[model samples]
Target: MKLNQFLRTALVACAAVFTIGVSLSTQAPTVSASSATYKTVATTSIKKAPYHKKSSAGAIYNASHTKKVANLKTYPYTTWYATAKVTLKHGSSKALYYKVKNASGSVSGIVWNKYVTPGKSPFGLKYAKSAVALDVNTNNNVWTKNPNTARPIASLSKLMTLYLVRQKIAQGKGTWSSKVNTSNAGLKRLGKSNVFGGFKFNHNSYTVRQLYLAGLIESSNNAAIALGQWVAGGSTPAYNKKFIGMMNNQASEWHLKHSSFVSASGMEQNSLQPYGYSIGASKNANYVSASDIAQISRHFIVDYNDILTDASVKSMKVDGQTLHNYNNLLPGRKYYQKSLKVDGLKTGYTDPAGYCFVGTGRKSGHDRIVTVVLHDENEFTETRSLMNYVYNQNLA
Candidate 1:
């Protein structure tokens, strides 16, 4: 009986040892995916395929997100089907990544969930160097990309010029009908330069309202300079200095730290030599941050809403010709949208600034959003996308 009991105990021990061996054999090195908790999304359950849309540059990785499989540009406009979403440990936090692939399975990889959106490929400011979108009424920043970096603003400087002139008008120092003589030889010489888009001001003169419209709508450098001269009482060197000081003071009053102006028209310092202004360097031009531009637009629109009367006008008769506005987002313009009520804002361009735009739009006239894009290859389309994103997302 003792022998039989010992044999039974040995058999039991052997069985336990086998179980341990099996468990050891099945053990695996902890993989990235195994360490991460994830959920598998059924292919049929997906209502909309996601498309790659990123605010910044990133890459697609393997399932474990440990290996770089592809760059973002590899699958342009390719709709992705998400197979799984994994929440991976990243430093002290966690991030979600989606396992995705194209319809034909040609493109497959893991991408950050923030870099994609559902539905069709929408226009994005991804290519723009700097951008911002803000809700004017609530002072909510909807979206921003390098907003505080100061860059050449080109014609956007005119907005400040307009603001100062409007201030003078408000202070009872000038009227819209105030006539500004353009008989200065330097002013005439600058006006004749076709590249700057100025009118013939040799022996001619224009009212404050006309010059204002010309500067805002027509982007006339001479008209802006003429107005600046009027404000400073002359186009002499001392007067130009005074006007530039005024521009800087106004910016200070507005609390804009990333803005400086050398010319009222936003021309480079060398370009303003016709006005007795000495050229310093090619980079000596108006510099303003995208954020500051948006703020300036908000202040101008809030205080001088009437400027939109001329700003919204697509074309105005100036210098015996129809001068069309450079802002293509206006109604009936190149990039106009029926859903958005885009009104007066501004557009600017230069070699250093590229193509820049400060656009304001309303969904129902009560909800206004201001969008700015700088150094954009497609300013109008990007602006449209920003406006649409703000309104559609209800970010405002």
Candidate 2:
């Protein structure tokens, strides 16, 4: 009897220990953001929690779970970088929430018990004055800041020009081998200081393919205008208008709401006010939102795989002249991000737009990503940083 009793007690003690261990293993930790613990934890950008708001911020989600704003609760503790502190009226006790001011301006919302993580904003989004980042396959907006605000896009305009030229060629409206005569404007553009990737009027006429490549590779204003004229039936005023109309029509077809095109070369031109906001001056330029530019990049890659495949050409041999590709993000080039599998895309810049880039890259175990940056002096830096954050966060 004594032996049996002892065995029973031993078994009970062992079971108790086992239960305690299991309980410890199952429980998650609670730590503040400022706790030296932040370094140990994997930190990323601000993210919408996987969970949904059971009730809107203003609505009372409280200890008692009542509708009264006073009934809303407040958390006793908060971690650093967890949630932005906007002054919003909350309940007297628990589940307190406040207003959050987004880039658009002041806004009202509830910050629940577990909404935003408190800590340093690791994404460096403050540097992105106007930008959009997304996944190509899902078409999801992974991250954006002032994405709808339109701003001038310099040579990035050439992407559309390239697309149109290819479309015309595909439809039998234009041919690569067809001889396109350089206009007097094209000739006069030579030796002008404003011209980029320009040649010195060496040839009277260039093949359609040569002109198109010149614009794409070298970002030559002269080549782009020449191609535009060719598309417009020889660069006449009426013909140019017809071509410009086509560009607008294409933007519409793509459902681009904020993008407007005035010139094929992405040179500065007057833009219309999509939103009536003025410091008493016009917001005119080749305006396009980061979101619109990102979509364009996604569509360009999906629709024309050849652009990615053929973007490897560093320079195009046009008769005797060599026009170089300006995209430094390409493989084996300077400013290349090894982690970012960037094959092809375009870059842009102007006085108003600063520097812009439409970048595409593939991350491991993920689909392609399209990133657009505007109004940054170092476009390359902004693009690379954003790409790194997106891939690391796995937001898509």
Candidate 3:
């Protein structure tokens, strides 16, 4: 989310990448009793045909005929009021298209036949250059301007740091209450060039809890390195090597084919070479597909919720110096959304990753969605826009 991890005066650290860019429910949310309900009256070339939502549409385009359309996670039978066999822009083969209103009863739009039937949306990390949004529970159900592409994930890699540390705690290897000092190796990372969210590494010692919180909350670079060292067997280079392996192992365990991690904190490996650390041959920052990132967040929802709740801390006293979360959407903050039940996941940024956010929120307490925005110019606003589209459908 920022270069200097130790302190944050504001959440405006990542340079915006905004271009533009969810499933989520089947029933059309009814707003008022007076809203119109049409009893199908077939006439002309029109006929009512019901169709099931495709289990996976890799993406939902706006117009369904060409550009982008908002996608919902809902998969109930949709009543198509009209259908027409037409040629579309995406390909040369002519196919049937439907103008259907989903069960949610929000306004209707054009939908291609394949997405509603036995066929599914196209797949891959296809469109990740501009942005990507995903439904946490569904397979291959996502929206992206560019999927099937590899992109930098910046500080989002800290999610792995969060996961691994919590894994150790769950294993009784360490506890949040454990005490750990800022290793000389960590302190040396304080002024490394190209590192972000910088904070002065003044204190030599802090509770294990403090350093852990700094990595997730403030995205403190040194705090992440310090925690890596601590868990890597008492701040030794050899152990840290093993720790990095653990991170990759976790990714492999998740079957994230397009994802790779060279560091625990998501900083580019070569960028840190001046500080005497090399991340082996790739010399890259962490990389993850938008879909895998969504799944990673879903894993957070299922396994590491304590980290999520702690991450929702808009402000916390870390060693008595308050640090603010970079995710501005957390409730009670100036940028929070009143309509959406906003909590948190994480945020990331770097020159290569552009401005990225792995944002999560829900409404009515259960329909959680994890959205990944990569290479965005306006990470926060664009993320809010995508979340709004999902919630606005009244699917939840």
Candidate 4:
């Protein structure tokens, strides 16, 4: 009897130890973002936890869990600083959550501990005033850094011009073969300057197609102005005013509230004045948020996909002059990646705008990604990083 009793006690103690070990193995070690030696602990998938509000899983909430402060989708692949821990009731049981904030302190809320781990930001994005990556196929605003802040857009104004020209064609008002004369004195002055990529108008005229290709592919200031002039009927001061008004009106129609345009060519008022065009404030340039530009790019590729044929072409022979694409990520270029079929979009620069790019790419049998890097001299490099990161992330 004594021997049997001892065996029973030993078995009970071993079972107790086994249960404790299993529980310890399941609880991950918590690491804060500020930890000098950030260590990661593997976390198991969490079961649904109840909250007082009708909240869904993976939501960041207030202290009392009565309101959801943010959805995790907005900060994709971000490494949040875990500041505090709190225990909240989940039905008859309790669960733990960590209070987390972004490095800038702009985003702060409590999230379930399973949603975060101690590590660097997965994006590792830098070298730009503002940046963003959006998935075209899913329509998910995948990731952003300073997305809403407005900055000068420079030659990107041509995108709006292209959109309008397409609209004009669809309405039967014009065709690609239509001739737009570039014989005005201002055009002559632009050609003399020569730095603006003004078309050498042999007959002082180019079809809408030539100007469109030059403007889209080469960022030609002269081509942009001529296209706008064609749209507004002529290059007179009244026409300049009408064209700028149309640009703003179309922006408003799209509800791009953060976009403001001053010139059709995206040049400063002073620069255009030398070429005999009057528009917005002398010092003011075209200011658009990176997010708004991304939105515009998304609409562009989806509606006017034919723009890609022109945009992806590295060079085009226009009136015996070769126009090379400004984008470096296209095929057979500096930043080209075979897997990342980067095809179309735009590149912009001015002293004020620095270097800005709206780049689009897709992997075969996958959704397209639209990326933007604004006011950075290394626009191409940063855009590549943003695209690579967003593609690897689960934006959900």
Error of 2 at 103 (Å): 27
lDDT tens digits by residue: candidate 4, 162-184: 78877788889999999988888
Off by over 4 Å in 2: 1-121, 190-197, 270-284
Using Cα atoms with residue i matched to residue i, what is each candidate's TM-score against the true structure?
0.69, 0.64, 0.66, 0.69
**What lDDT does the true structure give each of the candidates?**
0.70, 0.58, 0.61, 0.70
Write the residue-wise lDDT of candidate 2 on 184-262 in tens digits. 5433444143434365446678888877777776676667766776776775434544666677788999999998877
Q: Give candidate 4 misplaced runs (Cα > 4 Å).
A: 1-120, 280-283
Higher-scoring candidate on lDDT, 1 or 2: 1
Q: Please estimate how well model 3 matches the true structure, expressed as its whole-model Cα lDDT.
A: 0.61
lDDT by residue (tens digit), candidate 3, 1-396 = 532211113221111221211121122212133423322222124555555455434123333333335443322223333343322322112223456554344446655455565322232222236455666555433456555466788888888877777788889998888876665654556523344544545566677788777888878776776677677777655565678888888889988787777777777877666655555746577777776777777787778777777888887877666666888778775457776666887888888887778887765543677778787666666676666655544433
**Every model's Cα RMSD, please?**
18.2, 18.1, 12.6, 16.1
Compose the digit string of candidate 1's lDDT tens values, residues 1-396. 000000011110001111123122111112254344323332222443556544334456776555667665433444566766655443333455667776545458777665677674544466678899989888767788899999888888888888888988899999999888877777777777767655666456788988888888878887887788778777555676688779889889889899877777888886676556643534588888999988888889889988777788888786585666877778887678777888868888767778888888788634788888888878887788777666654567
Residue 16 miss distance in model 3 (angstroms):
38
The TM-score that candidate 4 achieves is 0.69
